[model samples]
Target: MDLFIRYILIGIGNGAVYAALALALVLIYRTTGLLNLAQGEMALFSAYLSWWFTTHGVPIGLAIAFSILLSMIGGAVIERVLIRPVTAPGKSHLNVLIVMLGMFLAINAISQLLFSTDAEPMPKPWPSVSSPGDPVGRSARLLDIGNTSISWAVGALALTLIGLCLFLYLLLQKTKLGLALRAVASNPASARMVGINTSAMLMVGWALAAGIGALAGSMVAADRGSVSPGLMTVVLVYAFAAAALGGFDSPVGAVVGGMIVAIAESLTIGYVDALSTIELVVPFALILLVLLVRPTGLFGRRVVERV
Candidate 1:
């Protein structure tokens, strides 16, 4: 029983990371109506930035903050310089996909070129046992109960996910800027007529998504005690599954979907011997299941078009 409980906690930690990234995906999809295939790579670069900051003597928290800030700026710049031209109103949305796919490869290659593919240890905020050579482990316990213990890493992940949920709720539901963003998302022509700068709102949306990705990327790398150019690749897959399962338009659903997917993966991995060599298939299967059964997902709003 303790072992099962421990596995559940581990799944929650991984789920928190997935929820963070899925939140970013849903945010962008909601605000800009574009799915960024390169979102993970953008986050990979941010993780590298945090790692670089740490290597330069910056504290872990502050380093993550810096990474978020820079990633926000970078996101805005990318939107203005690369994405804007393709995503202009009346343009083919297919261009958006093509550009994002290109960015997927480009950003990964750039991060590797700039930082090298070598994986490096990242400093953790919570107490952890990690060495220079092997930088990730669940060593410090946050809670102990009989034979089951929760690690600080897991606690941090849960807290961060909760905090992110609150922050996003406040930002998107309670603030003027968020209201304007929502307006733009709903209809840019209507929003522009109301004196909102649709382009600026779009840029803000990208910036916000990138900043969230920065947090997700940094925390995942920190928890693992490693950051690398390809750090978010596999994690991105799970995140996508979470987003799809929860509904791409629903942030809350993303969180729930992440937890569901993670728990399912954990249980299957723990008890199913046949999946030993193909664990990643768990998320892919979920994705297929969700798509086939409920395309809009649990919380996603369905789109109705006049034919």
Candidate 2:
């Protein structure tokens, strides 16, 4: 029981990052009606920028801020330069999908070319840094119960998740910009007819999603104590599973789905001897099971079209 509880606690932090990425996925899906397969690579590149900035004497806070800002700008630029042209009315969306898939490879390769494949320590932006001589986990230990404990790093990640949830809720539910975003997401043609800038909204959506991914990716790198070109690879898989389980169009569902996936991964790996070596399968299995019952996911709105 203690072991189970410990695993759950550990999983929560990882789940939070997955939730953040899943939120990004949902955002793009809702706004553009498309899945950006290169999301993980984009995030990895953004996180790498933060790492690079820190190495060049920038404060951690400033580095993260810069990363988020740059990612948003880059996302907007990508939409304008690459996505908009392909997404033009009556244009074949197949090309855009291909572009995204191509980006997945291109971005990863670019990351490697720009910043080798070497892994380096990522500075913590949440809590104080650990001493050089201290054991890796010692400085991060935050909560303890007998032989079980949760680290400060993990707790910080959880706090970040809470912050993101609140930010998203307020932005999507209470602001004018958010209203425009929602309007566009719901019906781009209607929004365009009503004088809303549908193209601009779509750009904003990509920018926002990219910014979220940057923040999540940076925090995840800090938590893992390392930054590398392939940092978000496996996490991306879990994130996609989370998005699928929650509903690609629901932010709240993304968070819930991420937590569920992480916890499932933890408990399954911890207790099931057979699964210990194949942890990645847990998320997909859960996805398949959930999808089998609810094709639109737990919170996804079912769309009915006239045939």
Candidate 3:
């Protein structure tokens, strides 16, 4: 029973991290009508930036902050220089997606040149809690469960997710900027007539998405005790699946989707022997099933063309 509780906690933590990044994908989709296939790469690049900062004697927290700020700016710049030109009002959105793919390639090549593809150990916030041999065994870290034994990482991840979700909700529901952003997303021409800069709003939207992606990357890498170019590969796919399952238009949906995916993955591993060996494929199959059944996703808005 205690072991089962531990697994549930761990699964929840993993779900929160997945949800964090998935929320970013949903944000871009909601605001720009483009699904950024390169969102994972962007997050991975930001994690590299944080690692670079830490390697240069900067504190981990400060490094994370700096990376987030820079990633936010990078996102805005990419939108202005690359995506904006390709996407115009009353035009097909396919070009924008293609440009994002091109941006993905450019970023990946640049990262390879700068950081190399080799995996490196990421600095952890709590490295002393566990050692090579302990009473609980190698599979479990020394988590504070009041003699019950729980995964500490899971608690931290859940708190982070809750805090971030609250922050986003406040930003969107209780601020003037959020109102303007919503207006622009709903109808750019209409928003422009009301004195809102639609282009600026789009840039801000992308910037926030990228910044959140950075946080997601940092959290996952730190928890795993390493950072690598390939780390985002699996996580990103899971995140996208979460977003699709939740309904792209609803941030709440993304969060729920993430939790569902994480639980599903955990259950599959725990119950099915064959799936235990190929865990990553589960999300891919689930995503295909969801898309085939719902098409617009669970929370995606239905579009109706007017003749």
Candidate 4:
């Protein structure tokens, strides 16, 4: 039972990171109607930027903040300069998809060129020790139940996820920008006709997604204790699976899906020795099962069209 609890806690900690990235995916899908295959790469680039900043004597928290800001601007610029042109009305979605694919590859190459292929450590934002004489100094324990211990790092991640969700909820629910974003997402032509700048909303969506991705990348890198060009690769896969399982269009679904995926992966690794060697396949298997069972996803609404 203690072992089970420990694994569960570990899964939740990992799932929180997945949830952050999944939220970014949901944000982009909601506004742009496209799955950005480069989202993880964009995050990787931002993580590199954060590492660079830290290496240059900047504080870790400030470095992460700066990176997120830069990522937001970069995301908006990419949308305006590259995506917007190709995404004009009646244009082929394939073109945009190809562009994103190209971006994924290009960004990976650029990161390697700019930051080198070597991995670098990322400083943690939270203090390592809760108090003096604590045995687990790097990650202070938040709770101890039986033999299971929950760390401050995990708590921090969970709080960050909750805070992000609340902020997004309020932004989408209460703000004028939120209404405009929803309008554009629902019907771009109608939104434009109503004087909404659909293009700007799309850009904002991309910017927000990128910013969120930066935060996710930083947190994940901190947890892993290193940053590299391939930092977000496996994470991206898991996040995609989570987003798909929860409903790509549903923010709530993303969080729930991330937790579910993490828990499932943890359980499989802990209890099923045969599958441990191929643990990476766990997320893809879940994606396949979800697709087969519910094509629209757990929280996704089925589209209804009139001929």
What are the TM-scores, per candidate, against the unseen true structure? Answer: 0.94, 0.95, 0.89, 0.94
- Would you list the C-alpha lDDT of every candidate in the order shown? 0.89, 0.88, 0.81, 0.89
Worst 10 residues of 1 by lDDT: 130-139
Residue 201's lDDT in candidate 2: 93
The TM-score ranking, best first, is: 2, 4, 1, 3
Task: Tally clashes: model 4.
Answer: 0
Clashing residue pairs for model 1: none
Candidate 2, 1-307: lDDT as tens digits: 8877888987898899999999998999999989888899999998889988998999877999999999999999988998888887788889899999988899999988897689877788865546666422223577788888777888888988899889988998999899999999998889989999988898999999999999999999888878887789888888898999999999988999999999988888888898887988888888888889999988889998879
Off by over 4 Å in 1: 129-139
lDDT of candidate 4 vs native?
Answer: 0.89
Off by over 4 Å in 4: 129-137
**Residue 117 in model 4: shift from native, Å?**
1.6
On the 0 to 100 scale, the lDDT of residue 28 in model 4 is 91
